[model samples]
Target: MNTFLNTLNSNNMQTKKPFKNLKIFASGFLMLTGLVATAQQTTGDVVKKADVDPGTTITDGAVRVIDNKGTIKYLQTQNGITMLSNTTANVTTTTWQLGGVLTDSTFIDIDGKLFGLNGLELIDAATESASTDATTESDAGTGTGYTILVRDEATGATKKLLATELIQSGQEAFTATLAQTTFALTGAPVLPSFSQVWVYRNGAKLIANVDYTVAASTVTLVENDYAVYAGDIVEIQYVK
Candidate 1:
């Protein structure tokens, strides 16, 4: 009976010893796993907060950003910063002033041909005059009206009439007489007191009856006819 009791106690001791060893091994493994988890967390935090070193070389496709004042700068290279592609930046204010009229000397460098208001019309510089007649029982009289000539400033160039010349009697004004078309001024034997006749080309009125006369195909006017005359002033404008 005593031998059996000693054998049973030894068996109990062996079982208890293995159980203690298993508990200690389990505790050690748990501590090792916890230490590995803590190390990973510390490394991640350091990486997140650390600045990129200047000596570090980044390959293509790597991206980094910098905050400068209110602008966000993108790192294009190790030492260079640039605005990001397709990003809009703020601009400053600007002012503008009105410029005066352009002159002929202004340089125009546009493609194709250039034209201006003067290019549309031909101008003449010759002066011309026409006659007006009024006849009464006691008086058979003729008065004259003059025209100022404006010609193309360019040499050998001809100008076309901008507007036709007309005759006015009382409240009636004659229709425009076109160039190369003949029309006669036929009226009562008596001429109206305010028989104001005039001519125009391009909105400019010609000088009254003192300077112009019509020949077969051309109109001629002398410079002296521009002087104001004692008789009536008539306006005649012509262009060819």
Candidate 2:
């Protein structure tokens, strides 16, 4: 009987009322842990403001260049450059404006790449080809006044593209002057490269260099060759 009474007492002790505060204590501990986690930097931390001023930075292998007004930027490996590029919204050609001129190496670096201006030659010719339609490659369209520009090496004059294949050799003419053998040419033409000189005297064709020698449009008769006298009809034609 004493053993039974002892077992019953042990059972009552084991079944004693559970404390309500324990669950609350555990709940408060989880809440406190959450608050602590919010208070401290755990992971993926981000700073709202930085201590340095950052300019412009592009990512390189490890680090790149950057600068800012507030602080000196990190990684000043090379200088930064700003180039402006402008174009029509849907145009294929883009024009780039550099802040300043670049060196030859710089030009080569930008122009000689695989996808750079490889096929295009120097812009020595400005007028469009005859085979090409007038509407093509035109800023305004049509050929009323379109002229290609080519620098005349011999004459040192800039020639306008006349047609699909020809140019206006600065049209030069000299009227006859009686007793005068010399004539002056305008400076704009630069008068050096003429393939042929036709001299028409008294409505008749005169021989070249034989009758007169011409150098840069300074016409002078052959020595003692005053065949071209005063009031003679003379027409000088220069063809290049």
Candidate 3:
């Protein structure tokens, strides 16, 4: 009976030992958790909070932000920062300003029109032709109230004309026949204004209304000392 009691006590002691080890393991786990929480709190205190102004100069790759009435505005870069939204920042003499010169690659889009540096036309040929067709319906004669945009060849200046003041028929050149008195224009262009013809006899420009008279499609030379003989070269240029 004594041996049985001793064995039963030894079994009970072994069970109690396992319970003590479980308590020690739980205490060690709690200590490890406390250390991690303390480390996280220390890290939070060391981290810097974003402020309104952090000085003007900043290193590259460092992010800077500003809070305006609970709205955040981020500005960070070595050069310029592209704003995705509309900016109300004013250009100041002491602050950032636009460059004086624009390169050829720079372009600006206003409404649906695309313009390049120094008022250059940046549209393709097809788009420009379509726009011109829509504006001027194949004809730009006088009294049509349509304006023609003309550019100065020498000065590079552009101007608009209400009437067809600059429209001119292309130069037409041909050899005169035997005793050719009347010459007909092959293009059959209409002349809105009279006395605007420029006739050239043998490559020399002649005075209008003095050398020849243009009536409708015919150009008849005045019965003067100079007459157009056979094989004589005749050139005519006039505003339609």
Worst 10 residues of 1 by lDDT: 87-96
Q: Model 3 residue 171 lDDT?
A: 68
lDDT score for residue 160 of model 1? 30
Tell me the tens digit of each residue's lDDT in model 3 across 1-240: 233224336556564553464456445545533422422333333333222122232222222222324343332221222112112331110122232222122222244767445865464554333222224324444232335567667754555654434555656887988778788888787654446777888988777777788888778877577777889888877766
lDDT of each: 0.32, 0.42, 0.49
lDDT of 3: 0.49
- Which prediction has the highest TM-score against the true structure? 3
Between prediction 2 and prediction 3, which has the larger TM-score? 3
TM-score-superior candidate, 1 or 2: 2
In model 2, how large is the Cα lDDT of residue 26?
40
TM-score of each: 0.14, 0.33, 0.34
Q: Where does candidate 2 have its weakest 10-residue lDDT segment? A: 74-83
Candidate 2: tens digits of C-alpha lDDT, residues 1-240: 233224335555442221233245345535533422423344694333221122222222111112223332221111112222122232111111223322221211223446334575543346633433344344544555444567667855545554644533444456656567776666634343334666566666666767767786565555354555656656666655
Question: What is the per-residue lDDT of model 1 for residues 1-240, given as tens digits with 9 covering 90 to 100?
Answer: 233225336556564553464356445544533422422323332222222222232222222332223343222211111112211221111111123232212222234757344554333335533423322222223333322234456643333331233433322223333332222233432332212333433344555444444443223334453333233233342222
In candidate 1, which residue ranges exceed 4 Å CA deviation?
1-171, 174-178, 181-183, 186-196, 201-203, 210-240
* Model 3 segments more than 4 A misplaced: 1-132, 135-166, 192-194
